[model samples]
Target chain A: MMGKHAQNRILAYSTPLVLIGILLVFVAAITLTGDKALGRMAAETLIRVVLVVGLWIFVGNSGVVSFGHAGYMAIGAYCSAWLTLKPQMKSLFLPDLPSWLAQAEWPVLPAAVASGLLAAFVALVSGATILRLSGIAASIATFAFLAIVNTVYSNWEGVTGATSSLVGLARYVDQWVALGWAAAAIIAANLYANSASGLALRATREDEAAASASGINMYRHRLLSLVVSGFFTGVSGALLGHSIGVLNPDSFYLGITFISLAMLVVGGIGSLSGAVVGVLSLSMMIEALVRFEQGISIGETQLALPSGAQEILIGIVMILVLILRPSGLMAGKELRMPRFAPRSPDYKTSNN
Target chain B: MTSLAQLFFDAASLGGIYAMAALGIALIFGVMNLVNFAHGEYIAFCVFALIVPSTEAVAVMFLGKAPAFLLIPVLLGLGAGAAVASEYVVFRHMRKATPVAMMISSFALGFVIQNALLAVYGGRPKAISLWPDLNTPVGVLGAQVPLLQLIVVLTTLLVVCALALLLKKTRLGLEMRAAAENFTMARLLGVRANVVITGAFALSGALAAAVALIMATQTGVADVRMGGQIMLVAFIATVIGGLGSLPGAVAAGFLIGGASVLLQAFLPLEVRPFRDAFLYTLVIACLLLRPQGLFAASSAKPRI
Candidate 1:
């Protein structure tokens, strides 16, 4: 053990060094990747963060993993995509939504919120049904839910442009803009985690019978957390549509759902830092692996790989994460700085 | 009136498939709550078993029309082989790990198997022959049901009965159930953990392989993607019927089979597009209300 003063000094020096190093690295990565790709990648990563964290809210708490948020995200994306993009194609496709509603095209602000709300609405209804079920039941329900959504979106082309990818909501998303939104989502989840409501959610996850005995209305609490999670997931999805400026049902499949879960597992469930680390590390590592494969030649003839290498890598990573550090890189821990001089009088935690 | 003969015939056939798939999934999940994410891949592997020996070339001498009757033992061997391999590689290390660990590992293993297939088969669907002359439809209310489907249904009944008897009568089966019922008590009572656990994987894997053969016959067209679809449906069936219940799985299989057929038949033009979504909503409603399942276990296992 060090002396109190030495400990304080070490903490102060280490804190700045780590922070500066992280900042420099993040900036360097952004700079090296080119602003355009980074912006898009960051937004995509953030959207993933939202979806994964939303997953953690349910799976992390319940000790049950879900394969169905893809179902929820699809609903959210389609709902928002339909709400925002259909008016122009309305007469041509749907000819169903009331004329006035069909004619209305809201700004990005309300549209994004509407996306979250719409997703949450569905989640609330579905969660009431799913959350009431036990672990595997609830998970399988989501999987069924995804297939159901895919079936609808692919078949119900009238409002959705059918299986032909939805397009033309490009104005709502920008890389940097999405990052900001992602940050806000992270903070919101953090706040919720520390709140009384969050405490109940955590307790339920940790020990259900005790929490239930303590008078926690599990159904209500689960619905609440899911709804909140659904909200962010929806926004991320709308941003997904906006970012791509093109969307289709297949975009959110088992690939995305399980991949996100793997990220959570690798990063550490129940930790915000884990989410960031998972997305950043795996995504970059995956990209790097692909890039690395560029030079290696396979035999008499230069053997270029066909598709699915990325998927294989993901599987390998997931296996690695499970075997080594199974709880994930972070294992439900936060990234924080030392409280050197204690809280200043003026500092306050803001709700927004 | 709806053609009861046709509907029943179709439901029976589809239910046959679902029952097999659900049995495989239920066996694995019951023992471990694993939800073996790699389930579908194994199905693909079974389908590929016949294809590999016949289609992909190493030794041409053993290759021929690959008699249909040979599929049973072949698939059994393939399924058992896949199960043993997966157990050795992934599940063995994960024996005492958390459910999440198994789930992710299963997911990883799934992709690995899938990609390995892709690497070998090149991502296109493969056509495999289980037998000849699938067109004959024997009697049964005058509905022209595929004789293969009939064969499939009878085989299903036989298997389910055999499984039920095995579970209730055999020492290994009893020990397995005892272990599932109460891991600690069974262990304390001298049930060999390794044998019982490996047996569980063996049972499921063999079941999956058998299901894959039937599925390959049913679908006609085979691909790497086939396993995933079967896995998903099997998962849904087991979940709805209640995880870990063999009888429950069969019941759920029949229900889902009937639902899938009906959804295709009675759907209105306006909402025909969202039939799948509607099916999911149906499952969601069942789960939301039942939580445990349509046939959930009567007793808990102390969170083990």
Candidate 2:
């Protein structure tokens, strides 16, 4: 018979493993098709998985909705563009880069890591002050951070091309690469969620007064989560820039911010599984809708959805889902393997 | 000095618009914990209501053809109708959900509205002249201000006074105030929850309609995304003013608008485009200093 502690450990890890398995299956299935568009869709979905999972690290644990992660993504994307682009292209488009960065051209892997680190550094500094405020105040402060980042990026012509697209990024990120990052993000999120700080932050989320009274340092835990969350979000941004081979400030604004948040919330913001599931489900629905818009043949008839019906339908579906399941589709429960042995009386599953 | 006077009028006019939008958000937030992200869509909807649905360069005026006396009330009613319908259809069922869920739902609702508008009217912004005579320059306090600026300021003052009277003197207003203060307690004390909530939505929607009319007149162009920028500014204003405080929201709205105008006027030419970045940074600092907000009610504080 398996020991309870071993069983509990298996349960704790099963969530991420299952999520990674789902991603692997998705990648393999798409690869079999060998279709470029399908490959791009799969890669994009995995990138979202990384983003929403990064979001889950902070929002799911701290219960503070951050509208600022996309700002970190912008920082990461720009930093990667600054690092990876050819020196000649940089000089022509982004002439004002400091001498060292202007001359330097790094491989995609190191640049991506460096981008994530830069984003984490920024998150640490910003979250230091912003995380002090609890509840909606913190949420708004994060939003302000996003707005500040967006404005500066949009207008910083010398560096960010000032609303113009920054091209020449190495298109190195494919389905397999995105899958690796998504798996890494899921692992990071899972490890963070099960960490001591994660538990402490969640305690604060559940009952701030009680948690504080019990000696949980809410600020420290929240900042830690934000930093971790920012890192992966930044990496995802780098991947997105590399995948598309172009970066624009507008791409990392309120639209992505809300959509990612929507995915997190819709998938059940409480569990790691929810983040992954939300991205896959929503992405698949969108792809299917796009395909439908492109028209489908059935028995000598062609059927097509209106061009913009997808967005309206998705919005309506989101509303319907919320109305039916307010807590989200996962409802804060992690998917665990079935236990054949009698359960240990002392063992309890962590809900967060 | 004349430039300063001109700046002042410009600031006040812009501030007045934000104040109105912020008030609309604050009203619903006062009664329900939900932040109505769909409020912006209501503004867009009202603006589009003035024009017939067509994907054309020039918008054909539908309600825009009506005289001011008839047009204003009809638009306000349409705005109110939209808000009430949303509240009844979407939000009513979400009463028991968490604030985050409700917020997402509201966002989804706004998305639906925006995309629906996008489908009906193509992506391009359409020009529709409304009260073009109001655009003529008029000297005010030794400054050449657009007549619409003066009108906007005056209309804002009139609306504030009328709202003040209604809130202070009307029975429905008292119930709303009570509900806003403490919904559960007010409900327990026999104030009808539905009536107060519905009244707030109606008032908020009418305010949005008023903003729509002013924006349409001032810009003479109606884009599907036009309301989004103002809505974001107004949302920031609502929060900085203290989420549930009506007067605070208005005050913050004007303050932000004034700051934005001043920053635009005074910032170096090279840095003027980055003015919004500076503005939002100040907003973060403001929140850091006073997380409960500059004008938070005592009840806003949690009893630990």
Q: Best candidate per lDDT, number?
A: 2
Candidate 1 accuracy as lDDT: 0.73
TM-score of chain B of 2: 0.98
TM-score of chain A of 2: 0.96
Give a tens-digit lDDT track for model 2, residues B189-218. 999999888899999999999999999999
The residue-by-residue lDDT of candidate 1 on A47-80, one tens digit each, is: 6766776676666665656676776787777666
TM-score of each: 0.88, 0.97
TM-score between candidate 2 and the true structure: 0.97
Q: Which candidate is the best by DockQ?
A: 2
Candidate 1, B82: how far from true, in Å? 0.7
* C-alpha lDDT of residue B215 in model 1: 79
Evaluated on chain B only, what are the TM-scores of all the candidate structures, in order?
0.92, 0.98
Clashing pairs in 1: A129-B288, A133-B291, A148-B276, A148-B277, A157-A162
Runs off by more than 4 Å, candidate 1:
A1-28, A32-39, A62-64, A83-97, A296-307, A339-352, B52-64, B269-273, B298-304
Which pairs clash in model 2? Answer: none
Please state the error at residue B168 of candidate 1 in Å. 2.8
